[model samples]
Target: MEDKELKDKLLLSKLKAEDKLKDRILHQINAEQALIPKKRKSKRASKENYFSIFGIMYAVILSLGVYFYSQTEKNPLESNTFVFSVIFVAGSFSIYWFLMVYMNYKKVKQ
Candidate 1:
């Protein structure tokens, strides 16, 4: 009976220690979470988005202008307006995608 009582006490102490450890872990998690600031979501990307769009529009217009100007010349086949336009758009989009992925990875790592 004495041995059984000792075993019961040991089990009780073990359970209490586990509960304390769990509480400590939860407290630490909450404390760490409180230290980090959350990012505010913007409802719209107005200014930057608009300017990026305008820049793209301007590029397309400029490319068209170049293409037309080349058409009036005798060496129309030598003009690379279309190729440059394609390269510019592809490069811009790929860069944007890369930046987005990098930003997301950073956010997740944090």
Candidate 2:
């Protein structure tokens, strides 16, 4: 190949590289905008999902209560630990379910 032609090709490649570098630098300068999370426009459906979760939680708790009750009957003097555990387990489930419903109502009113 001719020396002049080789020099022109090298110059073209250098220009392309410089253009790419400029774009990357500009992108980095405005990168903070993209880094910020986009706000959620609406979350009505998010309420329904929480309710479904609460429903499942209650169902599971009820099943657990039935199991524990039967077991305690089989052996009336199991352990203090078992009785305390059953009480707390049911209470936590109720609290969480109520919280989800309250949150759901508050969000829906918005």
Candidate 3:
């Protein structure tokens, strides 16, 4: 009876180890799936969602402003246009972040 009990405990432990290993393999597979970038889901190639004309204009203006600001006539970042441009970029990024969160929330609900 004692030997049978010991054998039962050993088998149970082996099953437990196998289950844990299986879970780890599944997790690894999921990680690999995530690493494989889904081309259809990527926004970078989407012309409709990618840089609009206004977005390009704003980006160009921001880039030029920042570049000019870095060149010393006076403190470049101190310029009102630079400050406003930075604010605009920050505001746009914040709005985009909120939109992403809201969209994700809606998706989760659905």
Whole-model Cα lDDT of every candidate shown, in order = 0.62, 0.65, 0.65
> Which of 2 and 3 is the better model by TM-score?
3
Q: Pick out the ten consecutive residues of candidate 2 with the lowest summed lDDT.
A: 35-44
Q: Which stretches of candidate 2 lie over 4 Å from their true place?
A: 1-78
Steric clashes per prediction = 0, 0, 0
Model 2: per-residue lDDT, tens digit, 1-110?
99999998898777345678988988997795654432232244555666676677667656766676787755423656556765776677667767776776676565
lDDT of 1 at 80: 79
Error of 3 at 28 (Å): 24
Clashes of 2: 0
User: Residue 52 in candidate 1 has what lDDT?
Assistant: 72
Model 3 bad stretches (over 4 Å): 1-66, 70-72
Writing each residue's lDDT as its tens digit, candidate 1 over 1-110 gives: 69999998888766335668988999999988865543322213333554575577667656766766666754433457655765676677557655765665576568
RMSD of 1: 8.0
Between 1 and 3, whose lDDT is larger?
3
Ranking by TM-score: 3, 2, 1
